[model samples]
Target: MARIVRKPGLRRRGSFRDWLTMLALFAAIAFAAAYLGGSEPLRGRAIVVDGDSLEVNGERIRLEGIDAPEYRQSCTNSGVEIACDKLARDHLRKLIARQDVTCTALGLDKYDRTLAICRAGERNLNEAMVRDGWAVAYGDHQWLEAEARNAKRGMWAYGFEEPSDWRKDHSGEETSRVSAKESVTLHAKRMFASLIAWLKSLI
Candidate 1:
């Protein structure tokens, strides 16, 4: 009765392969869900809500990667105060100027506002705001901020609290928010660097 001899190793290998296939399928499903659920681009005439926010087709969108002063916030220039927030908002308005704005959604913010990279014609509104110093680089556009600072453009010429700090001060909340997108990107970069280092060590 030596008719049955199934090797345990073969069964184990089959199980492992099945597990891997299932994992891959789950990963693909999750990716598709995230993509399909959000990330739909919004396009319409943009009404300037503030420096870093706009209303497009009745939808409120917060510009991603930049932060502008609160609408009521002010700043000091030389020895006089300036309504930097108003200036920033006005700058944004001028940039849009009744043009059809296109916004590509990244995700939603804590306030449930769609976070997006918006463009007016061929110009990137977010980059323009930071480059012109109407906004500060919250998670991206560090180089443009530097250039604006060096050039002393818009709010860079004035002394103002960072938008997040201003919000915390006025709202009496201790919220120092960082962009989730930026945090994830930074983590990925670090992981890649670590992997490269490990590979180099192996060499």
Candidate 2:
């Protein structure tokens, strides 16, 4: 019987291949952490979804500490009819202004939108909305909201139902009343208005 001998370089090549495989795995984990839930924060250009909702890099997020009027909800300012919901959304759009937004994931909302405390530059978007009177502080920012109300800013400048109240009163009516075409048209208008507002902010 002849003794078998293995080449030394062959063993070295096997070890190198093993190291490459480990490196690839680490890269994959890092990629997932940066893009999904991990130590890194979620950051992206945001699209205003509604008064209290936004989409960043295709992920929907809800402001953690505030609620704004629902789309189609109406109000009055000095007895003149105002579209409070649209205005609130527009106000948020103006604040974001095509800036890079960063969100710290707080959790998930009942609607499945990621609940987050987001910021544009150094400005906290959630608190900014409440301070400007476009949104009502829900969890613990009521004091800031009170200051906005006292100043009669944004939605506080008008007589309007609380967003939470409006939802209760409507209760499925919004979905039943708005046709698909009407909803699409309204969404387009809102986006156009947002674009114009963002452009103005740049000037």
Candidate 3:
């Protein structure tokens, strides 16, 4: 009978094969990701529906898949006006009450409202306001909601200084009614540009 010899420096042939198989699997996954990441955008009309919604240029138009403050509707946290109620009107006026905006309808919602995601130029308009502290994420969208919370963006940043809560102290007075200087407008424009640049990279 011949004695079997063991090679101390060599791994089992099956182990070598397993490593090769894993490398092949990883390569396949990377290839699939690159292949699926095509450059074409979704088909739609691309029109701004509101400060946060859009009407794509297709047969369908819908609110982007982001929840913005209902404006006129309200939510409360810690017994304070930490949510947007009819105040959503302020967002509309401040962001898109008159902007000739556009969107790329991506999908639809259950109520039949277009559930498309949208953008303004290269920036996501919905996200812009949320990030600017003008609005808050609505519903249970933990991802964006978390972003808003973490960045202290939107009403989340205001914390206890929410307009409604302040109204409790001053009887819902219009703070925006106070006039400001030209520098304020210039500062806002600059901030908007910065926000757009940041958001374009998101898509």
Candidate 4:
């Protein structure tokens, strides 16, 4: 019988290859977990604060990438005075009606509200508002804004002051008053009540 011969360094090479394979596998897993694990999807009913602001689960979120009119801002359409801000808010309310909202929290804004990209069903709320001309694109939504303008949608159909300009002209007290008045309306009141109920159910 021929004596079995151990190949020089073969066992060592096999062990090294095994180690490398294990290391690569672990690296792939670590990469996947690190990239995918931290995303916590936000979902809940919402309380619309204005056209571009809302609250979900007690956390205020300012819709990122757009700006809407202030709650008391006004404009003129065909020489007729219009409450552009209320119109914007009401449009948002209609868009978010009875839908579950989802948001990806980007970070906090200067006002400490969560800046987020939010969606209600298939609609990206930020883009939708811009496309509908109720909100102006702020960050990366200029294309949507231009499209809305070209199509003559929402604010484009009527002459309106930019929301930022409107806010700049108003005092803080006036702004707050408008928000307070809006919150007391029947629709807004019901929305707040629903928000409370939804939160309670969660606990």
Of models 2 and 3, which has the larger TM-score? 2
Candidate 3 lDDT by residue in tens digits, 114-169:
44344545556666665665544442244665676788765665443443345445
- Compose the digit string of candidate 2's lDDT tens values, residues 1-203: 99999777998887876776666556544543453432356999999988778899999988877888888988897788899889999989999988999998765544445777789999999999999999988677899999999999998888999877787788943312222234334444454456545544443
Q: How would you encode candidate 1's per-residue C-alpha lDDT over 19-55 as one tens digit per residue?
A: 7666655655565456535566799988898999999
TM-score of model number 1: 0.72
Cα-based TM-score, every candidate: 0.72, 0.65, 0.39, 0.65
TM-score of 2: 0.65
Candidate 1, which segments miss by more than 4 Å at Cα? 1-38, 174-203
Against the reference, the lDDT scores of all candidates come to 0.81, 0.76, 0.47, 0.75
> Least accurate stretch of 10 residues (summed lDDT) in model 3?
175-184
Can you tell me which runs of candidate 3 are displaced by over 4 Å? 1-51, 54-61, 75-83, 133-144, 158-203
Candidate 2: which stretches are off by over 4 Å? 1-39, 172-203
Give the best candidate by TM-score: 1
**What CA root-mean-square deviation does each model show from the true structure?**
8.9, 14.4, 16.6, 15.0
Lowest lDDT sum, 10 consecutive residues, model 2, at 173-182
Worst-scoring 10-residue span by lDDT in model 4: 174-183
Highest-scoring model, lDDT: 1
Candidate 2 local lDDT, residue 115 = 71
